[model samples]
Target: MTALATAPTARPRPARAWRAVMRLHRPALIFWGFFVSVVSAVLLWAYGPGGNAAAAAWQRPCTVDLCDVGYAVDIYHLAYRFCEALITFLPVLVAVWAGGLLIGRELENGTAELAWSQSVSPARWLATKLAVPAALLTAGTTLLVLLHRLLFDAHQVPKGWNWSDNGTFEANGPIAVAFPLLALALGALSGLIAGRALPGLIAGILATATASTLIGLAGPHLVPWKTSVGDLKEGYAAPSGVIYGREGAVTSTGAHIPDPCTGAGKACPAAHDIVGYYSEYHPSSQFWALQLTQTALILTVAALATAAAFTLLRRRTS
Candidate 1:
């Protein structure tokens, strides 16, 4: 009688289902692990303020500065800086969610009958399956952001220039958040909607790639608008005298009369380089706010995916 009474129970928590789902994603996990390991080291090494010698070999004089000096940064900095763009591609990779082939996998393998006959309920089973991937991905993204902040300053001033420019993601703060969320959602959506694993994977990848391309092209207008004094029209001034005119003690030097555009040249000192107008460019706080908002939106997508898959599973015929 006790054995009979103990026969009934809802599925073990969603966690078991979540783990089962994760088992199918070993390839993706490997890819992520390899990527994180390789990229983390690269980022840490590349962002070091100083490293590598061959970079000095690439330095060159600027055409607008007052001196012959040029901007300076090591080759590693350039490499690390390139990492900033990685967030954009994250979406394409993340779109492979557990939703696709989740029900389909069970149906195809004919395991739903045996599994559902046990203590698990459909919703709980689905919920548990999605938790692992979602949590791990989010954690990974957070770590990446912290690393970015730790190794680099929000506002960067390059050498040979006092201008507070060349900063990271000054253009769009939301970019980071939106892309990652987009990736995760896409993955899950593809997996769930595209029943077959291959098809679902492709759909996720393609969707992410498409969005990434559009954002890359149009992100400029969406970010912070940092004010800059770079738009002023410049004019060079010539010497006041023409080579001393061969008389009267040769006291006068070159004379540069200001001209408008073509007629707009200032009398620049001989020691100085070319002078030009610089446009005023400054980033607004809205830039960061927008980015943060975008991040939230993305994260929400992941949560939604989990909810959606659970709902679908609960109503599944199998």
Candidate 2:
């Protein structure tokens, strides 16, 4: 009887932890749910009816050479641009939420300390916080990315869209998902370091923006660029691809040098002893390679930031 009376009840730690996180961030979760739903709906519409109408409109004969593309085409372009813009800025939004609300507010309000006193180690708490959101963000972003890719693949026109465009490239692959995770980690780290909501928010935004900018600038160089050479008489005959470098003259000795005269008439090639013109670019075939490389880089940074957040939390709690 005494043994039974003295026995402590076994609480479900995982469930309780999940519930605590959900309760604390219910508002953010609700907003996220709404945002994902609306974006998904827009993407689906664009994928099915909207895409079909736009394609049909393009097939229609125009009375004039410069005719209007019709309302369907306009709407489809608007939807595509709108979705792309939102997805591109999702990381910034995530950074704001993570830095200002997720970690910073709790630390500032003493809620984190209170929770720590209630049998929740700071590490577990941080892990739960990151895990839940990372899952949610990944799921939402993955769905949006698949939808965006479908839309892009189906509705692409030769003149207006290219796989290598910044907005399109980021939205159409795993980078879409990876970037939000990176932003979340950056924001959490910023929050931990700042130990205040406003400072954390500002720092998080700056860090995320800086990281994103650097990655964007480095994206083209992540993979080996293919060079295309064309005879001087034939002019530059590079295939359609993402041109990363200016067209330059190639000497018979295989040296690449600036064109002595871009506009100096046909005499320029012979005068400079240029045998051909060369261009450095990434072809459509290398799309996945580049995308995967960028995704890996972003994920690595996210992991580092996550580790830093945990380390900071441990030091503060200990």
Indicate which candidate wins on lDDT. Answer: 2
Q: 1-318, model 1: which lDDT tens digit per residue?
A: 456456666755644565665676677677778866665776676445433332343344456744432334544455556655564456555664432344435544656555667766655554554556656766676666656655554223233211122325521243454566666655665665655667776777776677556554444444443322211232222222111111111112322223224333444322233233222232333445545544555556556755675565556645
lDDT to native, each model: 0.50, 0.88
Which stretches in model 2 have alpha-carbon errors above 4 Å? 1-15, 64-66, 156-159, 241-243, 263-271
What's the CA error at residue 225 for candidate 1, in Å? 7.7
**Whole-model alpha-carbon lDDT for candidate 2:** 0.88
The 10-residue segment with the lowest total lDDT in model 2: 237-246
lDDT for 270 (candidate 2):
80
Using Cα atoms with residue i matched to residue i, what is each candidate's TM-score against the true structure? Answer: 0.57, 0.90
In model 1, the worst 10-residue window by lDDT is: 242-251
lDDT of 1 at 302: 53
Tens digit of lDDT per residue, candidate 2, span 1-318?
A: 456456687876645787889898999999999989988899889889888888888887878567766798888888988999899999999999999899888889999888889888899999988999999999999999999998888774434677877698899999999999999999999999988899999999999999999988787788988888988777676776474656788998999898787778877778788899888888888889999999999999999999999998888778
